[model samples]
Structures are given as C-alpha cells and as structure tokens.
Target: MKESGRKQGAASPCAACKLLRRRCAQDCVFSPYFPADEPQKFANVHKVFGASNVNKMLQELPMHQRGDAVSSMVYEANARVRDPVYGCVGAISSLQQQIDALQTQLALAQAEVVHLRVRQTASLSNHGFGPGSPNSSGSPSSKLMGSQVKPIFDMDMVVDQASLGESMWSC
Candidate 1:
C-alpha cells in the first residue's frame, strides 16, 4: 500500500513548491501554511518578497510566531501589489483624514445646536416664559431644554459635503 494517501507515489505539492517547480518535501515548512488550493496567496508573497527571502524568514521565526508573520507579510504583500508606491501607509492616511473631517463636522453640528438653543432660550425669556415663569411648566420649550438625557441632534443627520471645505466657525 502507498503512503501517499490518494496518490500512489507522489504527494500534492504546496503552492510554494508548485510555483517554484520543486518537489514538496514531507518536512517542508511552507506546506502547512501555503496549501496547494490557494495559489494566489503564495504568488503574491513571492512577487513582493522573493521565495528565498520568505523561506529564510520562516526558518528564522519560532513556530508560534510563524503564522502571524506570514499573515502580516501576506497583507503587506497584497497592499504593495495594489499600491506599489505608498502601500499600506496610503490607506492608513486616507482613513485618518476621514476621521478628522468627521470630527470637524461633528464639532460644527454641536456648535449649531448650542446656537439654536441660545436663540430659543432668549425668545422664551422675551415672552415671559423663562424657566422660573408661571407658564414655564408644561411648555414644549421647557420640556425640551430640561430633563433631556439623550442628544438633541439626530445621529443619522445628513452632512453637506460641499460645506466640508468651508471654515468651521463663521461670524
């Protein structure tokens, strides 16, 4: 009986060995990680970092760290292939910029809410319906301004993209 399982004499080569056109040894380090099914995984890694270099790296790393190292290398390799110049850094920068823009938008929205609240309070005072007034109880404005725990702004409010470039504060 052959020890090759389904195959008689030869065993299926790993992706690395298949790409390199070499025999996949029984103790091959890459066989466990780079299976024959997913050829593109190894191909991208090989394209970004040479097979020799990858082999050396895997050999140098401890068994426990090998998987994480391989995952990081694959991610960086894929990113490098997509954006040769900036790679992962460009993606990170873009996400950070988006965060900053959203923060600014949030600040602007909060400021507008405060401005409107001040106007409403001043109008109430002018009409003798301020917080201490007799008619303040059961008033819609008093109920809205007092004892409200939740944020006043609608979280899903649409922001105007055109206003992103404008100054955050206006006189």
Candidate 2:
C-alpha cells in the first residue's frame, strides 16, 4: 500500500510520463532504464517515439527538390553506363561495315574467277582443243608429261649458267 500522490524533490520524470504528459510517480527504479548523463540520448528516444512530427516536416519540403535530387543520382548512373554501351554499339557497327565490304569484295572476286574461266574455255575452243581433240593440252597424257619435267633446277647449275652467260656477254 504505497502512496498514490506525487512525491517531493523529483529530479526528472520517466519517459512514458513525459510522452503522455502525466505526473511521474517519482520512483527511482525507472531512472536506471534510461541514460541519465546524456540528454541527447533521451531526445533521440523521444524523436523516435514521436516520428509523426518528423515525417510531417520531411513531407513539407518541395517535391521538385526531392525529384531533382533523385534524378541527378539516376542521371550520373546512366552517364556511367552510357559510355560502355556506346563503345560496344560502335564496335559492332564497325564490324558489320567491314563484313559488308568483305562480302562485296568476295562477290567481285567470284565474278572475276567465272569470267576468267569463260575466257579460258573460249580460247581453248578457238585453238582446236575441244574435249576429244588430239592437240588438246587438257589431255591426261599432256598433264603427265608436264608433271614429269623437273622445273626445280639445282642452285649450283643456275649459278654456273648465270656466270657463263655473263662471261659470254662480256666477251
């Protein structure tokens, strides 16, 4: 059966009593529950419990400022990403252009090969070297005879011949 009225000489009130705006019981037991030395710690606790006021203050700030702040951060991130993407796209476009040019060159080369083959066939026909003709160089016997001729002469023989030709010309 403790006293129900407020006690005398109370230093400070409990947090709950302060929040509720009520008279404290002046009990020393609740003092150990909170830090007594630092007033900022108690203030922080009060602010955390009373977050509605803080939120209202933040909401009162201009919308454009918040939007611009967010947009600036996003713009910086986008700028960082853009250079690499642009470089990759440029490289791909360059490779595609090179491939297109190579394809055109290949088509031209193929056309030249076909034209040369036609010309060779026309010349062979005019020379009386049609498929079964005896004078045709395309014959297997002619090819075998060509293959048997050794075109790779010895280096010593080439040097001797070159020297002999030079001496004869000098004389």
For each candidate, what TM-score against the reference?
Answer: 0.73, 0.33
Cα lDDT of candidate 2 equals 0.46
Give each model's clash number.
0, 0
Residue-level lDDT of model 1, residues 1-171, one tens digit each, is 546432345578889999999877778888878989999999999999989999999999999999999999899889999999998898888998887787788777866765666676677678787767776665535355675655354323434444533535331
Query: On residues 44-159, what C-alpha lDDT tens digit does candidate 2 reach at each position?
Result: 53444343443343356565564443344334334434454454456567788887777666656655655555565465566665566676544433443476664332112222
Ten contiguous residues minimizing lDDT sum, candidate 2 = 151-160
Displacement of the residue 98 alpha carbon in candidate 2, Å:
0.1
On TM-score, the leading prediction is: 1
